[model samples]
Target: MARENGLQKSLFALLAEAHPEAIVTLQYQYRMNKDIMTISNTLIYDNKLKCASKSVAQRQLDLPHFQQALDSIHGGASCTKQSCWIEQILDPSRKVVFLDTDKMSATEERIMETVVNKAEASIVLQLAEALLLAGVPEERLAVISVYRSQLRLISQSLRGRPGVEIATIDKYQGRDKECVLVSLVRSNETGKTGELLRDWRRINVAFTRAKSKIIIIGSSTTLSTTALFGIFLELMRTNNWIYQLHLGAENEHTIQPPPSPREKRNREHKTHSPAEAILKNRPILRDVYNSSSL
Candidate 1:
């Protein structure tokens, strides 16, 4: 009886509920690489979503192009030890990346009612610039955040750099970008993930907007406090897609890989069941599963 809008379900929701067998879900997603689409498919679509074709499913960022751009930006200097991690995470072969800010000195600040994280904004801007320098068309790239304050900060810093759209997740709902950079702007010691992030619909929109590459920048320790994000972080760890930012001496940055698979499995085995149980209890997902059972 919990309706999407306050007191009533949308007509579409009502139809789907009344005629579950008549639901004609679109199973083929042509936009995102399969890896980038997995979270939404699993949580919202019941693992029924598929890539339209092998080419679309397997597409990844163009690494050589990015390297060439980096070389140009660095005056043809080879990638130094400090900058190697950038190259590794931005390597063209990676379609989905979770840049864990848990190890970095990144924290969120409140601006009136909205929130912003300077560290997260800085990292997002750096990566967006790198992507542009790598010859990705300005229009093909986007920076999405869940907070208006974070979006405003990024927009102010990115002034004069036209065409790379910066907006909140809701603004980009029906839109797609070739490369999308998401700034999850909630990081605190108390583990308070706000209500906006707790809503799975917005999270689904944020995850499914990218065509080739999607880079999610957030504090894993902080975000893992939420069940949905906990599952997401677990999946990222299982897939070896997490890259932790390590701040070295004199403020150098490095990307650290997750633990070995054996260690990861052992850790996951201890913490996975609660999130699974929570997911199973979610009403929207329960409806999906019930319809499928029919």
Candidate 2:
């Protein structure tokens, strides 16, 4: 299948099902509270919801290139998720959903066969920064996935973000959103979203919560190989459909490619790694091999 407008507009919206199927022997809660929804294709679902600022006010800012790009709803050519500006989500309409899409891959199964060590734990910084930037009301937003235990610390990171709630996908089973931002954290060849389940139904539950927009941010390679991306790509390949394809783009939200060996040593010595950073800062070390010798 091709990779284009992978998720159609209609495919992004949702309604209550009359005959909901019951497969797992589990019980959960569904909010009948004054359910809130955001315009511009926001959704509420059992698992995730996301939002991007498409406000008229946001559009008119005489900002730099980065800000202008962010203001564009589909700025695929240069869309980014900056740690600083994510606070804009607090404007009462959109909420954020951080996803982890690496379920039963070889990577998941073979982690420290002898040591029951923790998953890389520092990304909590990303989650914390997301909370601040999105400006989402904690009471109105949440965190969900199978990695609840690993992400529990993320809640601590949000103490100032209005005490956001957290849950597993099974728990998200009936709620909906106004604007949804479903993040898929997939570093795997298989795009399972880090859960044993990645069927269209699961994808459906995650996608069909919006009345206006649904934006998925995940491992870009997954789109080329996974069924979820394949389905949408297939649909787009045949039509004039186009959705912004952003992964590790330039401006913001770009993953600083993991440190190479030399870069790692420089960081350990508290020295600048780049020529510009080093020249301007002027660290007194000449040889990274021996910091004291230098």
Q: Give the Cα lDDT of each candidate.
A: 0.80, 0.37
Please name the candidate that would achieve the greatest lDDT relative to the true structure.
Answer: 1
Give the clash count for model 1: 1
Put down candidate 2 lDDT per residue, 1-294, tens digits, no spaces.
222555422322322233345323222222111222221122224333332333421221111233333443233324334433332432233222222222312122233422110222223334333433334333544544334553454444444444444554555667654334444444455544433235455555555443323333344345447654555544433432333322222233432223445556677777545654554535544445347545
lDDT, model 2: 0.37
Assess candidate 1 and give its lDDT: 0.80
TM-score of each: 0.78, 0.38
Candidate number achieving the greatest TM-score relative to the actual structure: 1
Clash pairs (backbone) in predicted model 1: 63-92
For residue 122, give model 1's deviation from the true position in Å: 0.3
lDDT of 2 at 174: 70
What shift in Å separates residue 49 of candidate 2 from its native position after superposition? 18
TM-score of 1: 0.78
